[model samples]
Target: MRIPAFLLAFSVLGGCAGGMSKDECLYADWRAIGYEDGARGASASAVSSHRQACAKKAGITPDMNAYLAGRDAGLREYCQVSNAFSIGARGGRYYGVCTGPEEGAFVTAYQQGNQLFALENDLAHAEHAFAAAEKRLQEINHNIDHAEAALISPATPHLERVDILADLKNLNEEKQRVKRSFGPLRRDIDVAYEELADYRAFLAANGPYPGAHSVTSASY
Candidate 1:
């Protein structure tokens, strides 16, 4: 479920393009905007986006001092290890917002959660590939049946029958190849499942972390 980096960049650019509306800029609370951004773990420089938006839309400049103060307060709410882990578990990108003594612990927890995300992603991919292979095998079998029936039919032309025989041979070979893939694919899925389960158990045993509501409701 992780978003691609390029897509994330595109979303950011898209947001910039749609920036603040004139009404929003006219009535903006820079401190609150800063707080929201900080709580979301955006970099301090994100204020520049607001500045540009307000400037373009309403000819108003953001109050830098108030915004930075609110952002600092908001960062306190966002830079928790528990929040970092939750973000990583959900396949969210970290923007290196946490710093000082907290950064190490935050990064470590995020890495562990990201590992779980990787396992989940791998299992999903394996399952999809297995399903695709099975579907192809079924299609190949169906084609072989039709080819076999055609080859035996009295009305089938001699030249067409020869071509059908060759097609049938190729289909059977491809079916075997597809069948051979099942073992490895299943093994990959099983391994991924086990890894995911183990990680979940490890997190459960070690955590009584703050709940989502508590994390989100924290004061800026």
Candidate 2:
């Protein structure tokens, strides 16, 4: 069987990394996993079937450990491919995608994929919270503005003026709390976006992820 030139180079590098040749490591096999740019439209069971089909074509052993590992290795290779484009040169230079070996790459790939997923979920949740908070702040601002307008009127009664002043003070305190929350909330969102963008770049350049995409509910 003829191996790709990239795989040959990967093997040479792997040897320097104190590992087996890329061929022995299954790096090429890992990269061979489809990085579908489009969503898998298939159901979970169907996707599993597709994985089986891929495994068969790749000549991977049927052992569960090896199967799962290969899937993870594929994810890492996909990330590497995606990141290459994201970090590429302005003139359109790109990194060569790895397509060799299988050894320990799967573990790291699977772990990073899972971590990225968790970060994405957290980001989604934070966005919802931020939206709610922003809406509330806008409402408060409107109320405060109306109150200030009333306070400026010559016809404003003493009792009513006192009430408006108190309300303003309370709103200011609430705004301060909201302001404090924004720092952390924004940080969380930023982290999530970074991780997600990395994953997305990987997918765009490489292909679709192995599993399902996350879905967020409107009310969440």
Candidate 3:
């Protein structure tokens, strides 16, 4: 069996805030903190130059705008000490706006970041599910190819060939099962995506939701 030259596997990221997408906002913060220049500090000038030369050989641009955009956005959280975290709610310091010696400061961060984190995790789950489906399909294809090859060969095998034939039938059934599951998986992903889109629209219309349940400060 011949495999297709192009195989499309779906991969997705969270629905970012509509007002100023999380990725773009994160990148802006990274730039504000001077992360780009520091990244090249560990590499010697010649090694960096060689990497650029190799990229050119591969028909890849050293100055990739899109790649840099992702790099900055992905790396921003790591640049800061407490950019994102998870903790229980213990609201006290006016929704923990200012840094205090109390424990509630930690909870405030968690409350503020929870929605974004949940959205991000859901997107990750969707990607993982899609990948698992793709893997199952690949296994089915491989089994089909091997079984077909075994059946046609004029070797002296009898019982083994019969087993291979059986395996081929099983693989066919597995393929149908995978096909059936895909529809439900797609529907679940679509529903999650719709929720994300709604949240994004909400954020855009009204600014980021206040961190705490009660009115905290005029700044937020």
Ranking by TM-score: 1, 3, 2
Error of 2 at 133 (Å): 2.7
Cα lDDT of model 3 overall?
A: 0.47
TM-score of 3: 0.47
Q: Write the per-residue lDDT of candidate 3 for residues 1-220, one digit (tens) a residue.
A: 1111121011012111122333344343423212232221111132244234434444332334443453344333322223323211122111232233533544434555466456656766886797799799998998898789889898829888888888889999999999888888887687777766665555444434333233322322
Off by over 4 Å in 1: 1-17, 208-220
- By lDDT rank, best first, the candidates go 1, 2, 3
lDDT of 1 by residue, 128-205 (tens): 999999999999989988999999999999999889989988999999999999999999889887877776666665
Off by over 4 Å in 2: 1-118, 200-220
lDDT at residue 192 of model 1 (Cα atoms)? 83
User: Per-residue lDDT tens digits of candidate 2, residues 1-220?
Assistant: 2223464345334312122233433343332222120011111132354445445555433344444454444435443432332222112222223345532343334444455556567778989988888888898889889889999998999899999999999988998898788888888788878877776566545433233243332211
lDDT to native, each model? 0.75, 0.50, 0.47
TM-score of each: 0.78, 0.39, 0.47
The positional error of residue 180 in candidate 3, measured at the CA in angstroms, is 0.9
After superposition, candidate 3 runs with Cα above 4 Å error:
1-109, 211-220
